[model samples]
Target: MTTLELHGLRVRRGGRDVVHGIDLTVNEGEVTALLGANGAGKSSTVLGVAGLERDTAGSVTVDGTPIRGLAPNRVRRAGVATMQEGHRVFGDISVADNLRIAALLLPSPARSGAVEEVLALFPELETLADRPAGSLSGGQQQMLALATALAARPRFLVIDEMSLGLAPLVVARLVPALRQVAESGVGVLLIEQFTQVALELATRVTVLAQGLVTLEAPASELRAHPERLTAAYRLTA
Candidate 1:
């Protein structure tokens, strides 16, 4: 199985270490939730592993091959795709254009097929293919961002804040899609603020507090013992 591994992972920002040494693993066909309050270093940790931060220190590997220092594009090419926090669709471009741009990483012969497959996964996009991405509602825009990531055919997906600013109904609709992605054999690292929502989707869970991992356990264990998460949230807050 394809797996993404992080060992002694550390991230520094503005001359301060935001994430301390942490070890994490994401296995294909599983959902791993990274949970914490604001400033708990959840985002920074994933960004560093995704090669979006230059001050990152640690070892990141895919399938046991070192890729900690690679460029973001190279990391993407190695089968890891990131859906950054907030909506990332291009406001001025057509929805098709947004997808096409993301598909650029694929080989020429595969680009068109990739776009078609992703759109199929998000059928709502097909009806709005020619509409400007900026015109879509918040939920639709977020869905587009997810579709764009899927267009890359990633083996490991790192999504930062999947439910930010989304209404309950919108989130309800999107969560199943994400579960489907995991069921389809993609290793997913989900950064979510809503504890209940993340727990619902994750097979395993890790909690970061004050830049340190306070909890790492199977979701079933946490689900059975809900009180165990109190320390993680208290420290993060």
Candidate 2:
């Protein structure tokens, strides 16, 4: 199985280290959840891995191929794609056009097929294809963002805050879709704010506190012993 590895990763923002040296791994076909409190440097870690943050030091590799420090586009070309927070999408463009644009990295012959596959994954987008992206509800926009990322056909996907401000019902709808993505063999690094949501979707869980890993355990173990996660959080506080 393929793996995305981060070794001794460090990230600095505003001239101070936000993520002190840390190690993590996301294996293909599994969801690895990264859970942390606000300001625990989760987003910084994601940005560093995706090459959006330049003040970073670490070895980010895919199956031993060093990809750290590469540009975001380069990272994507290396079979890793990131869906950043805020449900980022081209608001002025048609929903179909956004997917089409994301597929531009693939060969012309494969682009249409890629778009079709993403649409199949998020069938709701197909019905709203003609509408501008800005017109969709927040949940719909988030789905579109996820679809755009998948249109690239990446082997690894890094999602930062899959559930932030959306309603509970909307989050319920997204959980299964994400599970299908992981089941299809894409390594998923999920940074989630909702602990239960992460626990439900993850095979393994890694908790960060004060920019350090406070706990790493099987999701089943944490689920069975909820107090363990609470203790882990308390350690950082």
Candidate 3:
């Protein structure tokens, strides 16, 4: 089975280390939720895995191939893509153009097909393809951001904060799309703040607190014993 592994991963920002050495893994066809409170180093961990952090250490591997220090684009080419926090999209450009730009990493002949596949994943974007991304609502922008990542056709995807500012209804709409991606055999690392949302969607869960993993277990186990999660979060608080 294919896997995305992060072993003893560390990330530093500004002048201090924000993420201590941590071990985590995302298996193919599964959603691995990296849950934590605000500033728990969840975003830092995702950045390190995506090769966006210059001050990082340890191993980031996909199927046993090391890709720790590669550039972000290189990491994507290695079948790992990150949908960063906040709905990041080209505000000035049309939605289709945003996807087209993301597909630039692929062969020219395959770019259009790649965009089409991503649109299929989020059909909500089809009618709005000609609209400016900046004009879309927060939820729409988030969908576009996710579609942009999917345009690269990654085998392993890391999404940071999929439910940042959207309403519960919007998040509800987006959740099924994510599950569809995982069902299609793409390994997913979901960094989320809402415990209930993460627990429902994840097969496995890892809790981070103060730059360290406080709990790691199957989602079913954690869901059954909610106090364990509460205790894990209280450890750093």
How high is the CA lDDT of each candidate model?
A: 0.91, 0.93, 0.93
Q: Across residues 20-80, which tens digit of lDDT does each residue of candidate 2 receive?
A: 8889999999999998778888999999999999899979999899998999999999999
Report the lDDT tens digits of candidate 1 across residue range 1-237: 889999999999999999998999999999999988788899998789888997988899999988887899999999999999999989999999999999999899999999998887889999999999999999999999999999989999999999999999989988999999999999999998788888999999999988888899998888888788766667643
Tens digit per residue, CA lDDT, model 3, 65-131: 9999899988999999999999889999999999999999889999999999989988889999999
Colliding residue pairs in candidate 3: none
Q: State the local distance difference test value for candidate 3.
A: 0.93
Ranking by TM-score: 2, 1, 3
Q: Distance from true position, residue 229, model 2, in Å?
A: 1.2
CA shift at 143, candidate 3, in angstroms? Answer: 0.3
Please say which candidate is ahead in TM-score: 2 or 3. Answer: 2
User: Mind sharing the TM-score for model 2?
Assistant: 0.98
Quote each prediction's TM-score.
0.97, 0.98, 0.96
